[model samples]
Target chain A: MITVNNLTKKYSGTTVLNIDSLEIPKGQSFGLVGNNGAGKTTFFSLLLDLIRPTTGAIENNQIKVSESEAWKPYTAAFIDESFLIGYLTPEEYFYFIGELRGQNKADVDSFLAPFEDFFNGEILGGKKYLRDLSKGNQKKAGIVASFIGNPEVIILDEPFANLDPTTQIRLKRLIKELADGNDVTILISSHDLMHVTEVCERVVVLDKGEMVKDIQTSTETLQELETYFTR
Target chain B: MLKQFISLQWKSFFRSASLSSNLFFKILTIFFALYLIAMFTLLGGGIYFILEEKVQKDPLLIINQFLIFYLFIDLVFKYMMQKMPVVNIKPLLYLPFSKSKIVHFSLWKTILSFFNFIHYFFFIPFAVVLIIEGYPPGHVIGWTMGALALIYCNNFINVFLNDVDAVFYSFLGALVILFGLHYYQIFDVTVYTAPIFDALFNQPYLVIIPILLMISMYILAFRYFKNILYLDGGLQQKQQEAKTESFDWLNRFGGISVFLKNDLKLIKRNKRSRTAVIMSLVFIFYGMLFFTGAVEAYEGPVWRIFAGLFVTGGFLFTFGQYVPSWDSSYYQLMMSQNIMYRDYLNAKWWLIVIATILTTLVASFYAYFGLEVYLAILVAAIYNVGVNSHMVLWGGAYVKTPIDLTSNKKAFGDKQAFNVKTLLLTIPKLLLPMALYAVGHYTIGPMLGYALVTLAGLLGFAFKEKVFDIIEKVYKTEKYKTIAAYKQKN
Candidate 1:
């Protein structure tokens, strides 16, 4: 339920991302993949309106993100450590975000109950702030907090990068469960081809901000992605 | 609820990384806060009697006559000492909460600043005095409220000015011109502003005039913040074309040059260090406060030496004490390198020396205070570069607090890379120099005083090799400890 039209972002005359047109239907699981300078983060940032677009607009649901802030209620994103306030405890952060989304502390506590196993009992009931947590635990907290407020759209950038192996596996299961016949729109960018392919039904490959491939995942999709990378 | 924002802010402040790290610092900060409140109360309470004794006129009329001047200076002090509450807005930007509410929350929190409360500490006591002195209670209350409204109006104006540099500069330029006109008797602004405050005291209800102005300024700041609340929105981002500049001129100095260049870059790029450098430079003119005054208390030898030491050595004391901790972000990388410890220490030493020299040279106008004062400044500068600079570096070994170069929380002392031990250590450093000067002046005359201080500096310079060796050993032992502290990011 996102439409990007004539989107281009340039830095000092160097065009980093120049998407002509792209659209994701409601309830779609979308994955983006690109190498370091391929503008995967840039595109996600533009979608989140974290940075202004050089030209054109992004429509979330039916409202233009730049023109109005109405779409913010249904949208949530965990782009990086900057998305987490460093001073707040994990539970406090969750409650803060939940409060912003019209949920009380009880609602947030209930929302967090299902992620106890995912947190491995390390994040909650702890005196340490989110900033003091290990990178993997920090990522877990950020990812779980995005799930609060029952958001319709969630954006995560490099979500699988710093996670430990067990957490990564659990996250994959979590994503698959959320996307299974769910109306939630999940958009994630990752360098891990296998995880993205398994979790996301449709994967888009970008090269230097240009959309190079949009493939529907299948039995052969893994081999095709491998070939594309090796080539 | 709107109250959640305040509670979250409270959590952010008390749970701040540094505040929780040391119990001593927390107590000291609270003590300092209470001390300031007590001082303000005394000043505000005493003003009524002081005015009564100085000029047989009514204190209210006297205050009203200078109210505009007071507000103008208050505006400058407010801008310098106060900061809008810093909220990490990225996480909050996309939340469902309205942008205006976030702006309003920040504005509401700004009212909690120590600067704002300090006004109440001043005004409330003075208002009590006014009522006790048989002034109409209603009129005194109205005058106090009116004055407070204008104070808050100044706060909002300062906020708006702080946001945009062009606006701030123009605002300052206008104020300077107005002040200059009054200073030279070219204009009498007191003739106009005195009546505005007079009306507030007379009618009691005319406080509404400033109340309206306060609301307008509040709305002005609110609209400005609301407009910029969108992520990546504010002013148009200017992305300059990237080009690498070479420091080849520094290449001739060998490995020391490399360290020097890095230190320079650290000061240039980091927010906290850069601000320190600017403040140290600004402090060089501190002599203006002590030397230019006509008051006899300021003419004492103690004040002269204190001001002289500050005029020359301020940079060495402030910036030198944090040399090692300034590189806290990359202390591990530095220790891991094959670079000699002497080079690291010498590079920092040289930077401090150069900074002291630069500050002293820029402040040479202190010569106008006469040759005696100029000689004291020269002696102090030499003492600074020699003895004080080395002491500061030695003090750095004891300072294990890691500064967050990225987040400039407040301008002074909050993230300063020194602990209470070194802070206490500075008292001896300050007093020893002053005592030496005072001893020489009182016992043997000013020339002997200069010679004594200058000789002490030369003595320190003569054996710097020993000093550097001792400091290097201290730093070597503390390097890993410092790295661990720096790794714990705030």
Candidate 2:
């Protein structure tokens, strides 16, 4: 389980992310939704310890994320292109990430074998560096590389944003597979409420750095999210 | 259309993200430029008098004999240093302007480069001296104009030189062969320059040849750029074939070697880091320039050791300074990974130490300079691997600005403007070694000097674990700041 307790991040005395308490149980598919300044990324940054929180602690599986590196082994995230090495081929990048996670090249190769459909014949065995790839292809590389070591927690921010419709559907299925079959805890942040609702077991709405609603996903969840946003 | 393009470029320059930080350096650069202009002017004005006292022949004929050599050196220097300043044509390509006009404007822009003006800095003063010496103004005009046409021709030729690596190598190889043939007294390669330049003064119309040559080069450059001006052509970087190599052998060393292999790939794959690697190679031969001169020219162990330090520690100076920033493109990925700071820093230190050792081995041939010279280099290399490498990595922890690997196209890519902090950090790295060696050399003895350097290095090697702890602490404390800085748009 991940516990975010009294986490608040301020930029020049202006609070950006303020959360009193939030619990994300292991092996659950959780979704985060918000507008541009609603602090979705700020919250994620604090969770990853990429930025320091003004006042609070985040614990990942009983280990404080900032105080120790123990969480990094069991946690994986793909926040943006900053997470990808631009100069490496997708395969090299995969092998690099695999090696970091204590997986051998053969292990990475096998893990990536089924991802060909998701790669759409463009990523692996190709000469193009990640930077040269189209944005959707680069995201595919980043997202799939996050899955290499089979980390218990996977965090993906806006995974379906730039993707083509076909690839978007493929990614949704991939997320569902990890959430259900592999017993992985998945945290997804997306502006596309329809996609997030389809994949997440529970979805939370963040309004200007505060949680406004936390609801269980059901058949009418997409409509509920759409109605909230439209209003 | 040209005015609009110029205005757009001006706005981009002032509005650049780096402009605020680079403003101080810009002012410094202006003073540096003034110094060069002054030096060139002095050289031009004094050339006649200097030659009159030294050479038996007429100064004009003697200098004319060397004009081709001067032009060759000028062209090569410009090839190394000059960049076409502000004609990024990609955005302008889709505009209403004709493609040829854009190409023409780009070509015309090079004519205004400070490089072309340097010829006047030297030649106009030389012309004044000629006129003062009673040479006809008409002849001087023809000669100077012809000389400028050739220089501009070189400027245009540099455009083609950028695209053809083979041609560049051939130019270098050809220079070596020509210099070799001259060295052996087999031929005088500069035999033709005197006549061509003399003909410019005698038959003023002969200037037409150089003018024609300049026009042809301009046309060639314009046509080449125009051909590739299409949106999907040369302006768009072609996807390169991913060169894959199995680093399976490095798996034995575990995490450290993984970073080592990845860093090796970083240097191999990125344009900026690769330039740093090649520059280190160029500095390896820097010893030859001083070593080939008479022994008395640099008699002391100090100068010999100085050159040796450069010979052996070249890669350390060149590539070590930009340690973590070379990975700035993917630094967040590294920081967020499960990799330990100890492993990452140790891997970098090892890579540079290995490079120093390799360069030292290459310079062992400098034993031809004598065991004394080579031993000085060996001692310095040992010191470099042990001490200087750690110092550089320490400095790297503070590099707040990130290097944009793909976009840094400066010929001196190591000096490419990003951080003054990096430039400042290089000082202690350079001075500490020299100061340590010099202090021991001056007070105690040469043996103690070598021993001091060697001891310093050994101590650094011994305490590296302690050093790494400090470095790691700095990394942890600065983590959020580095992440935020690296995320800034280049």
Candidate 3:
């Protein structure tokens, strides 16, 4: 479960994020959609306590995000490649993330096994560092590592951006399976309306840092998003 | 557990080794060249001993002094390459590892560096010569091992001291006290030189001092290692107090504020980038070690100009060359943004320019230990603003193998130097500046002629937009070449 109340953030006198009273029940998948500079990343940063909100608070699973240590064990996020230490090999990075969550190298390598075909051996290969990988592969590595511990909550930013279309479909399916099977709360921000529609139970739309819409995907069709963007 | 840590270290080491492997032959060639030079020095010293009735006053003290000064500069230079710091520290923190083990591993890593090989080449040969010429084996062994241990111990101490919160001022205060003592003729060896060198040359017991000092330094290094581990967290992240007016200087050149803000934000967001700036100042103490010789060498007009040039241009040339590429993987965010490339270039240029001007002024005063180097400083500043600016700016644009600012290891030559184009680019930038100096010296009387040429360069830099336009055209046309060049391992 997650609750955000009056979550506002600003940069240089410009309001990059302004939200008012949004809630998501446990085990639900929520998607964030908007044009560039929509404050999606800012909102994620605030919830993660990576950055402080100007005037707001977020509660994840009944624990205040800014003040609680409970948030650490319950949440994992990959907001960007900045979150990944590029000097590390993919396996080393995964083991590092896993160990932080009290898992061993066996668990990390096992988790990495499912992606061998998808990663094309590039992710775990010895010849290159994570930095030397293509953007898509690096995202795959970051995303898998973020999900490695199976935290109760996951937040991913622009997960589909560098991914190939086939991988995008696979990721959407994976996100849905993760939310439904593991009973996890997942929040994802993206520009792709179709992927968000297919994967999320509800979508929160932001424009210029303010929440413009919060609607269940079952209530609003994909055509409505096209109209919204064009308008 | 130590074995496991060593295994992890070997993994890290081989990763670097693989990068180095790309230049294995080149490294071997350089090694051989240095080996031959050492052999020559050994043979020359032997012939000198044979010719003279008595030893031509063992050059050991001069060599030791040079080694100390060299290592000090070498370590400071290593720290300036933004990537070297972050790369060095990252892995050790994650293992079921003690910070002490990690620091020990890092200290071991320091010896493995190519620069540290200088001790083996230069110092060992001299020691061997002394031993062959009938110095007691204990004296030779003790002195050689003691000196090498001290060199590495000093490097470890630098890394340890660097982690302390007030290290910058502590080091500065220490230097000020030492220099004050020197000026007051307190620490000067003239009073103690006879006894000290006498003990060093004749008595084997004096070697114990450096050996004990090195052992004590190793213990201190372990304590520093423990301190880093037990500290609350790795690199404390504190909220920056947002300031509105501090970035106003960029408003003069429209949209320059964006890149300025970005650069400032980077300096704030990443502790390592700020370390690059601080690391530049650490050289002040290192410079003081040879202050007298450096000043004495600058007594001539040519060497004076060089001292002024080096004192200022050295910092900029060494540290300023790799600009925003220091951002490494994080660079994509800025590149992806709608920001103009020129504005980004201008912000970095200005940062270097400001650093250069401040350094030139300080170095002038620092160069000759008097105001005498001030005129050379003035001329150097003009050249820096004019001629050197273009060189650095162009060098920055073409620079592909940007080291990760967060990584603390010096970029492996095999990683960054595989491309022949890097050589091509460096040749013109290095040669043109020297050619200009030579022409100025020959055409005009040294001081005024160089000053006038520098003035002309400054005028050219005043029209930097024109220079940038040319650079931009090349950057655009060579985008594919640049990408291809950078695509290699480096």
Best by lDDT: 2
* TM-score versus the correct structure, for each prediction: 0.64, 0.89, 0.56
Clash pairs, candidate 1, are none
lDDT computed for candidate 2:
0.81
Question: Could you say which candidate leads in DockQ?
Answer: 2
lDDT of 3 by residue, B1-490 (tens): 6677567656665665224533644565466657756775665355435434454555554444334345554454333321222234554467676666666665565556644555566566666777776778887776667667666666566665454436745654665565467577678533444355345546667777877777788778666655644324433322233322234455465556555544664554344555545545543333443346635543444554444454555445544566545545544333222245686677777877777777765654564565544665566567666766667667666565545443322211112211223223334444444456666777776665566647666786888898888767665555433433332333
User: What are the per-residue Cα lDDT tens digits for candidate 1 across B1-490?
Assistant: 5777767787887876567555675687677778879988998899999889989898889899988988987886676556557565556767787778878877877777777778898899999999999999999999999999999998887776655546755765777688768867999788898988888899999988889999999999888877765445552232222222335576577657666765665676554576577667757877776777745567777667677778887667667877787766545434422346898888888888888888888888889988988887888888887788888888777766776764433211122322233345467677877888889889979888888889998999998999999998886666545655666665
Residue B408 CA error for candidate 2 (Å)?
9.4
Q: lDDT at B483 for candidate 2?
A: 83
Query: Candidate 2, residues B325-350: lDDT per residue as tens digits?
Result: 78787777887789898889888888
Task: List model 1 lDDT by residue over A1-231, tens digit each.
Answer: 999999999989999998889999998889999899999988887776556789989999988876655777778888777676554567766765675566766898788998888999888887676656789998999898777787889898999999989999999999888888569999999999999999998999999989999998888888899999996
Candidate 2 docks with a DockQ of 0.70
Q: What DockQ do the predictions score, one after another?
A: 0.02, 0.70, 0.04
- The parts of candidate 1 lying over 4 Å away from their true place are A1-231, B169-192, B235-243, B269-274, B398-428
* Residue pairs in candidate 2 whose N, alpha carbon or C atoms collide under 3 angstroms: none
Q: What ranking of all candidate models by lDDT puts the best one first?
A: 2, 1, 3
Q: What tens digits encode model 3's per-residue C-alpha lDDT throughout A168-228?
A: 8788878989988978999999999988988999888899988888888874657788789
Where does the lowest 10-residue lDDT sum fall in candidate 3 chain A? A123-132
Q: Categorize the docking of model 3.
A: incorrect
